[model samples]
Target: MATGGEAVARLDDGRVIFVQGALADEAVVVEITEAKKRFARGVAVAITERSAHR
Candidate 1:
């Protein structure tokens, strides 16, 4: 989760992952389309665990 309450996560290698169409506290599988030194951009491919809000 991100400080601003966005559905952001971190990879094991310390890469910041921004997930689009993801809900806060939702567990999902993402596909990284772009990778960078500080961050990575991705979209949620599957929601393994849905959030209570959903």
Candidate 2:
């Protein structure tokens, strides 16, 4: 997956998930991240905002 920036999403059950990449910025991998019940939190290793939104 790819994304431009960091993003945090809260599920209906209140689980918080964070991802960093271009896909996340454009909401492309939005549903992919929610497919599993649990996963590791994404750290902004580079911490750069490729997206214009930032």
Candidate 3:
């Protein structure tokens, strides 16, 4: 798990992770998929914990 601030992740992974309200900067368990673009978009299937930003 990794924590970052203002992570601008490319939405290529075709997984619908956490929506709004989920914490930011905390690593979350996600199911990711490859999007049309050359990046990975993911959805947080499970939130490991609250992010520091929360």
Candidate 4:
């Protein structure tokens, strides 16, 4: 998790995406809100799988 509770993940091309409303270890479909060279900001559009922690 990030400082503000965003879930951290990596894209297929290896860019880090900070996902809103997602939990660690959970699989989700992301909608990117912002993008930069090394990182991106996104929201979880759909949860493909959920973590037991949630």
Question: Among these predicted structures, which one has the highest lDDT?
Answer: 4
| Stronger candidate by TM-score (2 vs 3) | 3
Model 4 Cα RMSD, 1 decimal: 0.8
Shift in Å, residue 7, candidate 3: 5.2
Model 4: per-residue lDDT, tens digit, 1-54? 999999999999899999998999999999999999999999999999999987
Give per-model CA RMSD. Answer: 2.3, 8.3, 7.1, 0.8
Q: Which ten residues in a row have the lowest lDDT in candidate 2?
A: 25-34
Q: Tell me the tens digit of each residue's lDDT in model 2 across 1-54.
A: 425444666545666666655334444233343345664355444534355654
Top model number, TM-score: 4
- Report the C-alpha lDDT of model 3 over 1-54, residue by residue, as the tens digit: 224322333333443333332455655665654444344445556777766655
Residue 38 local lDDT, model 3: 43
Instruction: Give the CA lDDT, 0 to 100, for residue 39 in model 4.
Output: 97
Q: What is the lDDT of candidate 3?
A: 0.47
TM-scores, all candidates, are 0.83, 0.32, 0.42, 0.92
TM-score of 1: 0.83
Which wins on lDDT, candidate 1 or candidate 3? 1
Which lDDT values do the candidates have, in the order given?
A: 0.85, 0.49, 0.47, 0.95
How big is the positional error of residue 14 in model 1, measured in Å on the Cα after superposition? 0.8
Residue 28, model 2: lDDT of 29
Candidate 3 Cα deviation (angstroms), residue 24: 2.4
